[model samples]
Target: MVAPTTPGTTPTPTNDAPVADAAARLNRLADGYLVTAALHVAAELGVADVLDRGACDAERLAAEVGARPGPLSRVLRLLVAEGVLVEFPDGTFSLTPSGRLLRSDVPGSLRGVVRARGGVYATAAPALAEAVREGGVAFERARGEPFFEHLAQHPAELAAFQASMVDRSARAAADVLAVYDFGRFRRLVDVGGGFGVLLSAILTATSGVSGVLFDRAEVVASARVPEGTEVVAGDFFAGVPAGGDAYLLSWILHDWDDADARRILTRCREAMGPDGTLLVVDAMLPERAADGPAVIRLDVTMLLLATGCERTGREFGELFASAGFTLRRIVPTASPLGLVVLEAVPA
Candidate 1:
């Protein structure tokens, strides 16, 4: 009902629609954890893989995946609502296009990421409030151990983490190679390169570029590097391999704070010649929060999990200057991860 206004007086208009819409948005946001949990359950049960073979009823799916029929059906319905799955008229379930990403054998499989987020990352969620109140890592407070140490102790979680990294790096590599010219360098060293995914891609794409894959001793032990790649097992904090015209630190710096990142950059500086080039592939945080919501979310994840943080272009420049390097140029990539190649040269 609208109240009548006197002459020459403005009447107040009433519209509850915007308020209702805002409330609905907030409600959806608040319930996001439920979707995450459901996705985790489905991923762990290999529901998408099973459905890829063919659609099946909840009871059959439950029998195959060792889940209770009722709960599985509820989860399937939730996924259908979320557009990750589709429900047939015959009460069977099938994977939607988005749901196919959960399959373990797929090109961009997110099963590992799902396992990690739903398992270890979820474990640290409760400590986020405490971490905000007290300046410390949420994972360390929640699990009573550092992030990497926890991964070391838990092999399955470690494998999942590695798999996620591989999936992410594999996708980013194509985008990087498409934009950057690694063929200019004679020798390329990939420091802290896990499993040599990026190195493999570079070697495959560029001719006359010999690669050196360097990482921890344990990491390089099982590394499946390309043929002719020189595998070196050592700690980057102590030192990195020398003699390469270009050194690549792909998706590495974001796992450390400024001081630690500087230490790493210093090591690379020490190992490389004055003419050597350093290429750091990482997510460049946008200056404005609204412009880079995904990166901001990753920064929050870093706060929850480790001492690392995503950095802006200016921050990377400062870090480079502090480590005796001059910021050469930033090459933009078409990666969905918002990755950029920050090219630097020794001061």
Candidate 2:
């Protein structure tokens, strides 16, 4: 038996133990889909919600979740192995801290995200290799249509997608507010602001700032804008409404490829005045993938679902320059989503 590392060396020595550990990691990576499926099942069945009250026997949990006793017990046991659930000798299970995120009502609950993954992302997973090879969207490859077009036809999936965005936005909204000061701007326009979640939060936090929530007619119709805030429905590709001291494209640009993203920014630039600011709040990919795995994973998600690609700082600067704006600075935020505020000004 040899030690995996040499004393005071930078890199670990390639001993048998290190090789075995690496092999185990590869094995876990290969079987990652099993964990995803188990998590999706728990979320869909409301396992955490049921266990939120207290621990219960597998039989009781199975009955409550409308699953067969044996199968449900197996799922619970798997969850226990995954550290999402704790099983006692009495054959009962309870939610772990990680499992509580599956509860729909919690502050930062990921129930909607889990549901979305299970519903659409899982379907698109098989097309990833094809997407890499053919240079087309994976969701379209799997479903025979674009992701948004498919969502339009499926109301349930649309609802789940919207809910998932809301859940993600809840944290991002707070992060945007914490990092940026909106008080300097009299008028703030949120371009492609879905449901006005971040806009509302901004207006509430910074008094005396009016906002305009702009999106499609169907999306804006259901949005609840704060009092004194204006809601205008329109597409950013065609044109964005004019005359705002600050324009926000929160989590929007990352949904398109370079050409389409440039089109969107160009429209915003046309609407922006000489002194106006363009703030794009989204994940800015780090130089090293290991530095920010979540953001890199999000880029993969973009590849699967949309034409988007998460840009590095240099990439974003180029995008801004092409759209007739100068990239000013990248502001970091406290959100776990690894959000960054890209502040740009008219060139």
- Global CA lDDT computed for model 2: 0.88
Query: Superposing every Cα of model 1 onto the true structure, what RMSD results?
Result: 3.4
lDDT of 1 by residue, 1-347 (tens): 33578999875446776567779999999998899899999988999999999999999999999999998999899999999999999999999888999998678788877878887888899999999998999999999999887877887777777777777777888899999989899999999998898999999999999999998766677688889999999888899998999999998899899999999999999999989999999999988898878788888889999999999999999999999999999998876567899999998
After superposition, candidate 2 runs with Cα above 4 Å error: 1-19
Q: What is the lDDT of residue 64 in candidate 2?
A: 92
Task: Identify the leading candidate in terms of lDDT.
Answer: 1
lDDT of 2 by residue, 1-347 (tens): 44456688566545678778889999999888888888888988899999999999988988998998898888788889999999988888998999999998688899888888877788999999998998899899999998877887887787778778878887788888887888999999999898888899899999888999998776787788788788998878999989898999999989999999999999999898899999999898889888898998899999989999898989999999999999999999986657999999999
lDDT of each: 0.90, 0.88
Per-candidate clashes come to 0, 0
